[model samples]
Target: MKPENAIEVRDLKKSFKVYFDKGNSLKEKAIHKKRNRYEIREVLKGISFEVKKGEAIGLIGHNGCGKSTTLKLLTKIIYPDSGSIDMCGRVSSLIELGAGFHPDMSGRENIYTNAAIFGLSKKEIDERLDDIIRFSELEEYIDNPVRTYSSGMYMRLAFSVAINVNAEILLIDEILAVGDVNFQEKCFDKLKDIKRAGTTIVIVSHSLDQVERICDRSYWIDEGEIRAEGDPISVHEAYLTAMNQSMQERLEKEDAEVMEQHKKLGQARLMPVFCSDIAERKGTFDVEFSDIKALNSIGEKKRTFHSGEAVRLRFAYKNPNHVPQANIKFSLYRDDGILVYENNYEFATGKVLDLKDEGEVNVEFPTFGYAKGTYLLNAVMYPPGGGEVFDEINNVFKITVFSEERAMGVYLLENHWEEA
Candidate 1:
């Protein structure tokens, strides 16, 4: 029988002392007379949450964000520095799949060994051994040494043994990502069955889609703290928004630093120019695209084009000083930010041009090999090595392409199909 509250964690805090070794041998250590220094790395800060019987919870975050550490703490693999964890009923953990199995032992022997570690008696193991091996689909290789098993095979056997354990609380740490798609679906179906049978589960995974599908709720952990706790989909959305914002800020800062270095080198002047057209302008101080216009096949200033039509992209630049070594990189992106193609002017031609005043640059795409959809054009100016970008206009222009044939994806590959 499952308890009402399967697990309750209160102000959980854990840290480890990371060591820096000076010498490996005792003689060397004595000669150096230096002690190894250590730094305290806090893996889990004060965090609190609860899991009810039959509830499936998810822990999501970037790598080293304490998701795995929390699972380890729950399994008592490591003791917490402070705080309390109230766990009820028998617990079985698959922290690292096949972690405790003997490499030289046969898969059948390893199953008995692992199950015994999970608190199964010899008679209990005997009763479930056939079912476990059948579930893993490894009956032929059950007597083979585990060292010869492939990763997917190992995972199948490990998960099979784990699910067979009579555990009220299951701790899974991204083990489901292993194996083929068919086996993955089988694992999901099995999980659903177990969940319906009142088995509590805690899964730590990077796959937000799987998390949202399997977990009743999710907690986004960041910097060893609970950033958000709510519905799985909403929590994942919040996490993604925060991650994108942080990435954008870091990129902007890097761009600013690059421009500042260029200013110090006397390459260009730093001036924050204001854009008169808010809808089409995007850039920093070093360079700016004041006006951009797209021309169709008939030389008309339009933002839409037909398949295989000639499209010309024209843009005028504004700069404070001469950039003799600068080049322009033009790229096409889908509405969802997938880059389709990119081309550079000076880099392709092996020529450098000076831009001291308002200059015009244009590029023509003779064959617009894209399916019917809306797209964005991104223009960026950079130096020879592209170590730093002078200025970039993301989504400089939004254009739509028309096609007669309904394609599945964005690209249009030239292919002729005939049935044999």
Candidate 2:
């Protein structure tokens, strides 16, 4: 290990044996040996990284991406198949809280038992016992049997004991959701204090915002390897972009399958091409929306966009009756039910659509001036003068806007500041 580094990992590799259906009893195992067949699943593929002393880093990836496995190796809870991990100081982990607790033991007794697992001496645990109990806010029930405590209480006690250990290195998994929101905030503040005290911290979490607030650096792990590592915001932006692309591909494939199924069934009307399974629909069947998608400047489908980026809504409709004239309206509403933008084609251009057998329309926005938040989309087609509602799809789609700037309100306006 480098002298300046608190943790050094070299070409780490690990795998596990995933077994097929196998018998539990000895007699059944002997009779059906073939049922024990298994396959080797490689979780970490020669990944390497180092953490400087007193620096906090986060491991982020989708589930089953070997991030948790890497943390387990760091804690020595699991052995790596091929690689070396070096640590410069004593380690403590919040991976499995209450691992050494006995259900019948009192909360106070379990605190000592859990602290002992971190190699604390009897005198050392005695000194921290009061602090731990106080931090857990369980003084009233400290002497009660842990089995009688609620799930939140139990977790609070475990977390208090672990955090008070004051180890030189702390490895935390996704245990921040242990208690209520208030307690969770308290834990976050404690972590910040620990960082200021120069303790080396490594976290594995799916909450990107948490990582951004706490970690000095972030490593993006994917498919058993390190895909990117650097500043939290940049790395997370790349990770989210890749994830969005993957989702787009999946949606396209599923849409194609749905179209094929409709053709096979000879359905009179095809289902909405891009509407989510839970999307609500209401229409008179005289004119029905067959497809609706939110796209970017280059005509690529996307549900997420940066605030001020160009956005366009592309929709296709079928008019079996060939209605002479119709009006189209699209509205955007924030998740809290506040309307952001709503406009009709007739009002904007003094023209209404001359309906035909089938057609597609593109509504373009050069700059989507929405703040950073999710907005619900609604599409409506009705008579030119607004009589009977021909069709209306509530929540036809959800558009998410992201912004790097720090500001408030519903609109992302263009402005500049200068000294007078």
Candidate 3:
């Protein structure tokens, strides 16, 4: 029987000694390691929580905000500086999936090693081997060394191994975020099955939608403290608001002129986050609400499309500078580093925003045309002089395209398939 609380943590804290002399050569650190002075970073402060048996929980916060530390501490990868964790059952952690597998080993052999580390018998693994390979969707590559496998493969096999092990507790940190859309969907279905089997799940993710969708509860961590803990929707909302505030703070400190130029751009108002690309593309929908915020609206902009249908992408960003003749450029790439498409605003717009005197411009692109694959958007600010990029967001937006009826390929030709 599962314990009442699958995992219980109290007064948890984890700290690391971060060295500041970034210029110091490796030799210096090796020589003075014992006496080296370092800055103390309290990644996780004193925190406490309990996950009832079969409860699905999420941890969200800014990067380096101690969410990873908490997950690591619970999995015993790194012991807490001070606190206690009471785990009632076996844990299958995908913290840094395949953390200690030998690259020279074939996928089959690595599965044995990974399963053994989780305390599974070789016989147990053998019985589950076919299922593991099938779940991983790498049947043909099972005999190949993991060294030859792509990063995506590593994530697939790692996740497959973790999920297959029949553990009572599962710690997942954006694990499904790695694979392709098809693989991700398969993994999600597996996760739902796991949940149905009553496995306690704890997830750490940058994706608010996933948290809200799968997690029953959520936590927002800030500077090693539990800032909020409650229902997924409420907690995620708090995290989003906190993130936007931090981004604003970072921009304020990055440059003085940035703030001044932002003030000079038309009427100064925060950009309302736009989620509906289809609706926004027609230029007929404002999709605006006084309560809709940039961080909160991020999930809406990313629409999950069926395989054969067209996708409308909407991007809303504040221009920190009031430079005229600035055009937007977008680049689309598959997760495998393949450049699918690229286009520039200079050719699309042919002119500047007349409201350049204003502090901000919220532009929408109804970019439609693509095949079944996940594509990311790379945006850049183009100035007329072309001296340097006034602003740029590298792969800021991502969308996964999948249609059940569409065949897998780079482009969908407007022609019927014919047999030779």
Error of 1 at 124 (Å): 1.7
lDDT of each: 0.80, 0.88, 0.70
By lDDT rank, best first, the candidates go 2, 1, 3
- Over 181-202, each residue of candidate 3 has an lDDT whose tens digit, in order, gives 9988888888888888999999
The better candidate by lDDT, 1 or 2, is: 2
**Candidate 1: Cα lDDT at 151:** 85
Off by over 4 Å in 3: 1-3, 21-35, 255-420
TM-score against truth, every candidate: 0.65, 0.80, 0.60
**Model 2: per-residue lDDT, tens digit, 1-420?**
678999999999999988898678898789888887889999999889999999999999989999999999999989999999999998999998987999999998999899999889999999999999999999999999999999999999999989998988999999898799999999999999999999999999998888999999999999899999999999988887777666556656765676576566665544454665446777686887878888999888877787898998987888888888888899999999999889988988888788888988889999998987889999899888878788888887677777755568999788999999
Q: List the residue pairs that clash in candidate 1.
A: none
RMSD to true structure for each model, in Å: 11.5, 4.0, 13.1
For lDDT, the strongest prediction is 2
